[model samples]
Target: MTQTTLTSVQFVKSLYEAFAQGDVPTVVGAMDEDIEWYEAEGNPWHPGHAFVGSQQVVENVFARLAQEFEDFRIDCRRFLADGDTVVVEARYSATRHRATGKPLDVQAAHVWDLRNGKLVRFQQYVDTRRLADVMGVSNY
Candidate 1:
């Protein structure tokens, strides 16, 4: 086996793949201990929208997704990197948990900052209107 330094793009790609496969440990392991995670405000899941620390990210972000949705997936359309930051343009789709509703499909962008090969910051940009509609919120 060989070891290679993962580029910023490669790191983000690997993290998304791990997430898709429900590999929680791998996902968490990719982050710095004090990772700052942020999702757009004014969404239904605002409680879990922003947090610091990998533990907080796991509890607030991933846990909320698990509790509120099923089959949550991110389809990366593009990845662009500069220095230690990677920007992802993707589409997110998920089924509402225990509800017979149309699967939610929304466009989103993610900005990730990495240092020493571990993600230290993340901010999410999303189509709020579509996201709100899918989350069953008439207004955000």
Candidate 2:
């Protein structure tokens, strides 16, 4: 009997689904323990933006979202897969804390790499200036 494994694209799709449902634990559980999660540079949320390991990722990336934004959402539009890598084209929407001015909406792309069905690395590419502006960071 041949055992079929999930493709990287499928894995990423499921992860996004979990995220959409606000299932943070499920999303974090899919990552490798030593996952390298990278957010775009110049994002003012974290001083040191690169998160290594599952704990750091959950703490710095996911937790920060919950703390800083009222409603943080990612809308995945497309996914492209090549071998062990999956590229995601998505839009981000969020309401900043303590403000009703405007919801932050922006286009973003994420490059995810998987090893043996476990997410090993992720890199984000987005308009950091726009994100910073939405976050009310001066001189962004």
Candidate 3:
């Protein structure tokens, strides 16, 4: 006989649930203390090549988002999983922008790595063009 583990789809479903509930504490708590992340110009609040450590991530990324957007919502459309790796395609839309009185709507995918039952790394991919327009960046 053989034992089967939870599918990647199931893992991501639970993860997305954590996000959709506005449960930052749960999400952050699930991350490894020394997690790494990468984001692009589309996400100016957390734009960078790569970041290390959970504290740096909390301060540089999540906190930045909280400062800029309110009533945030994250939804995952599809997911692909293999072992502990989970890749999710999601659309994020927020009713309020922290910097301006406007809405922030974005579509993106997030790749995550789960190790020892905690998310150790995450990378969000989005269109730089759309992000720029939302941020109102004057030029490249």
Candidate 4:
């Protein structure tokens, strides 16, 4: 991992792939060992509340998302990189229902912090309105 820059477009690609696949080992392989991954609290769509660190990322974010959602998908549409920062625009599609496989499309964006060729911090932007509805929130 030291041979590659973590904040690069490729890093984001790998990160999303690992996350989309829910491959905890692969995702952890790319982490900085002291990485911090954040998600908003009380997000209706997510399996649960906000989380911090790589450990939480796998257990709370990745594993829970996969376990809760029947089929999860992430499509990275756009990406831009500068120095040790990367911005990615993506279309995230998934099915929260465990039985019928219906898609919920939500536009997403993320700002990543890279240091020493490893992902240090990450902040994500998402279409919360649509996502909230998908999570069965009628009055969002």
Global lDDT of each candidate: 0.81, 0.81, 0.71, 0.70
lDDT of 4 at 117: 73
Q: Give per-residue CA lDDT, model 4, range 57-133, as digits (tens).
A: 77776776677566778898889988788988888777654533446788888888888777788776787776666
lDDT of 1: 0.81
Query: What would you estimate as the lDDT of candidate 2?
Result: 0.81
* Per-residue accuracy of model 1 over 1-140 as CA lDDT, tens digit each: 00037777887888888888999899888888988888877656566546889888888889878877788889999999998889999999886643546577889999998887788899998888887777777884
Best by TM-score: 2
Lowest lDDT block of 10, candidate 4: 41-50
Model 3 RMSD in Å is 3.8
Query: Which is superior by TM-score, 3 or 4?
Result: 3
Badly placed stretches (over 4 Å) of model 1 are 1-4, 47-49, 97-100
On lDDT, who's better, 1 or 4? 1
- How many steric clashes does model 4 contain? 0
Worst 10 residues of 1 by lDDT: 1-10
| Span of ten consecutive residues with least summed lDDT in model 2 | 1-10
